[model samples]
Target: MTRLFNEPSQFADELVKGFVAANSQWVRPVAGGVVRRAPTVEGQTAVVVGGGSGHYPAFGGIVGPGLAHGAAMGNLFASPSAQQVHSVAVAAENRGGVLLTFGNYAGDVLNFATAEARLNSEGIVTRTVVVTDDISSAPVGQEHKRRGIAGDLTVFKAAAAAAEAGYSLDEVVRVATEANDRTRSIGVAFSGCTLPGQTEPLFTVPAGRMAVGMGIHGEPGIAETDVPTANELAELLVSSLLAELPPSIATAQDARAAVILNGLGSVKYEELFVVYGRVAELLEAAGITVVEPEVGELVTSFDMAGVSLTLFWLNDELEGFWRAGADTPAYKKGRVGSPSSASTAASTADTQSFAEADRLTLAAETAASLPTELPDSSDASRDAALAIADAIEAIAEVIDEHADELGRIDAVAGDGDHGIGMQRGSRAAATAARSAALNGAGALSALSLAGDAWADRAGGTSGALWGLALQSVGAALGNTTEVTGSAVATGVSDAVSGIQSFGKAVVGDKTMVDAMVPFTERLSREVNAGGDLVTSWRAAAEVATAAAAGTADLLPRMGRARPHAEKSLGTPDAGAHSFALIVVRVGEVLASRHSEFA
Candidate 1:
């Protein structure tokens, strides 16, 4: 049922509509979605910032009186096409020359470098500055490979201030580069985002799990683990960024740094501040000083539920500029502070809800119980399931290689992770499942082993639910040498019943039951209707697919995401999609092996 959009060949056109609407006073679309507006100044050095969209306010919001004059906006999470970059330079250049800056990513490097050349030919001078703050992107030896995160804010502010202070374009670029070199950042994702008008998310984070070092878009993270609490999450992110901070910065007497607590769209501000408070406390304890802490949605991914913390090791020059007066619709510090005084007085009479406190406690407890060690890989069924896990692992590698194109497909429905999570979980499961599979064990036995490994190795509410489902199915078919449609139906029924009992959820819960319940129900109808196993399975698969589709109409009612159930009505549950895929694939496998069964 998923289909691709063909109307807009390029994303820039759609985004420019929004950009011009938002900044008509200060910005105008010049060429190729590039905004030509600059902050008020004359004969002053200029700083230019740009990158793919979806990380909003980065290149665009940073353009103002105390910021860059013009910004070159790229497509969503993709580098601007070379022609687009070239056109932007034409609009941004002046007598003071232009200084270009963006995060350090391969596509960006290639595009910007090309733009630099084209600009020179036009007789406009331009220089480049790259930010490398994500320590996890590269090992210590390959620091250049790391991509910029929140730290880009500091570099932009400093660069802009320098340009406004009458420094030459060369000096501005140098100062900006220095700020980037001294800044670092790290992030974790709880959920993914979707492109505008896309029904499905680009990536997925399994329930009760988090993706550490997640890319600005839905790119893969360093690892997926049990979801951590605000405090714990802050601790981990801060520790990672600090580990990579220049030791001199940490030990210096003036080891002051500014923190930009960035929200990846849809994350509530209250939660962000909670995390920020902890980050501030931790840094203070570690002999680091926190300068003016900026907390808000500065950069975003359509509707992703994640956060990234950026720290800029500041010197007097940077600090002075950071505090210097500047105003933009999104990045203003002065107007924002003034409103709080009046709003706080009006809201004080209202009672604060303690609901977040309860949720926070539960999340912390859940994180603590996650499985870190893999279960024994000695069982045959476990091994086969692990093979499926291996299939999932292969998928992640595929995604990493094709990251540039993933958003196009994933933006349609369900988070694109049908490829990523399966790859990660299956890979982990296979490593544990293979020990038993290699012994040439029977199908049912391998599956049972896989169930155990999956439950133990995967660390989300989904993993636990799935592991339980598989274990129930394995138990129903104990000692069976092979699986037939009847056997599969029975296993599926038992698995569904087992999961339902513990989770106390129903078919319309927008969970896996959306697919499983319908498939099992149809399987029973087919067998009673007197069809052979294969025909019965095919019928059941059809039913499962329909039921999964039906979930798009039902809201999630049982889980951490329950509050978002209504919003999810038009999107199928991720678990349901996974189940449907498994059912369809299993049916195909059985059909192909029909002769063996006979």
Candidate 2:
């Protein structure tokens, strides 16, 4: 368990602050994350890599010469917001376009894609290469769906080296994509990791047992077996990766690979060295020549007792890039030259000004996307806003009550952060809604503010999806008048459509969509039948609750839970349960306050 922390919620921020202070020679703190203190090369593409915090050395420690130019650090086990990514990218870019690279997780994909679009819109050309190297996440046919793990280092290094070598943005992207395709990783855990201030780990392994194919974020492994010796474990990792070679690598005997024997967190260097010993012998026995293999902590979970092995199949170009010199706070290879004169401090002011301008432009674009015509404040609008505020408050309370249960359910096959995320998001949403209402905003404006707050505070896949749902509903409920049953139905329908479009989860995916789809259909039907808001919402909430319960019989097809799909069976999805709970509580609020709005 993590013992050192002022507050669990503020841990990520504090960690970053301390990291920057300690590594002042290599990194400088920025608005969203850290950037290299070294000067940027003119016309060289900036390689920006990032993900959730807790995976130390991975994000911040890798930011320096010949590595990531910047990293957009997010909350622990949560992807950075699009705003965070954009801010870091803008600060790091040097008029030479940008290459964004990160692991292939849902929240990271969504936020990185958003940031890429925003950057391109502002004349800062950007391209993305999502690292998908964890073989256990999906079958070969569905490789695109696999998650990135310890293998992230291979892709990030290649892209950063290519960028530092002055490769064009397109070339940098090409090399990074090739590296991702060629890399493969597998891992095992003896025990799960605990988040700060949490008394329990996300999951637990039976005594004398090891979990195989475990994810770095405390996700349970796909299988469990009696703990093996170091040699046996090394062989297991090597065999698993060798069994599924990339198309470019024909046979183990003819392959040349770059290897990384990475400690997840608590695993000591001596243990990694022992494992690497057998790993090296096995590769040589197979006639494969291992290049400068890295054997230490690279990517990590919070004190997880685990290790992963990454094999990066090498070509001539890739070999050169892999051998390139790099000097970062936590990682260094060979001797690196000093920064060029172009990277002088004089350009710092200019870069800061440019970054600020980009931020203002983004803010303006966001404002323009919302409704331009503001409605006059009236008694009906004020009352509707108040009711919306009340509903949010009720939802927050209900989520707080169920937070522990939801976290437990999520720990079965995930990182066990869902409950905490929902609690944080709901409370933030409620606060924002109440503030908006008190400031004379209507229902639409209040809900919109709440949505923004939820997304900003929650910082996960559920957070982003819920934010979209609320914002879509707010857009449907125009601020010009009081919301009626028909308008409410339209808003709910829009919310469903938005979530589906954004998350790409269908009813059988064992996600919130399982409950949301049924609820929306029922509400639409009841409203079309001339039912009032109270009756239709109550009926829809019942359907949602039942649908959520039904998820226990289904298999997970998305998110961190998918890798351990079997473990999730017979357990209700945390997201689905939370969604059902919130809607049911909100229905009660609407039922009690309907007459005021009417």
Instruction: For residue 70, give model 2's deviation from the true position in Å.
Output: 2.1
**Candidate 1 residues 370-389, lDDT tens each?**
34333443243343344433
Q: Give me the candidate number with maximum TM-score.
A: 2
Q: How does each model score on lDDT?
A: 0.64, 0.86
Q: Which structure among the candidates has the greatest lDDT?
A: 2
Per-residue error for 413 in candidate 2, Å, reads 2.1
All candidates: TM-score? 0.55, 0.88
Off by over 4 Å in 2: 218-223, 251-255, 337-379
Root-mean-square deviation of every model? 21.1, 4.1
Q: For model 1, what is the C-alpha lDDT against the true structure?
A: 0.64
lDDT of 1 at 519: 87
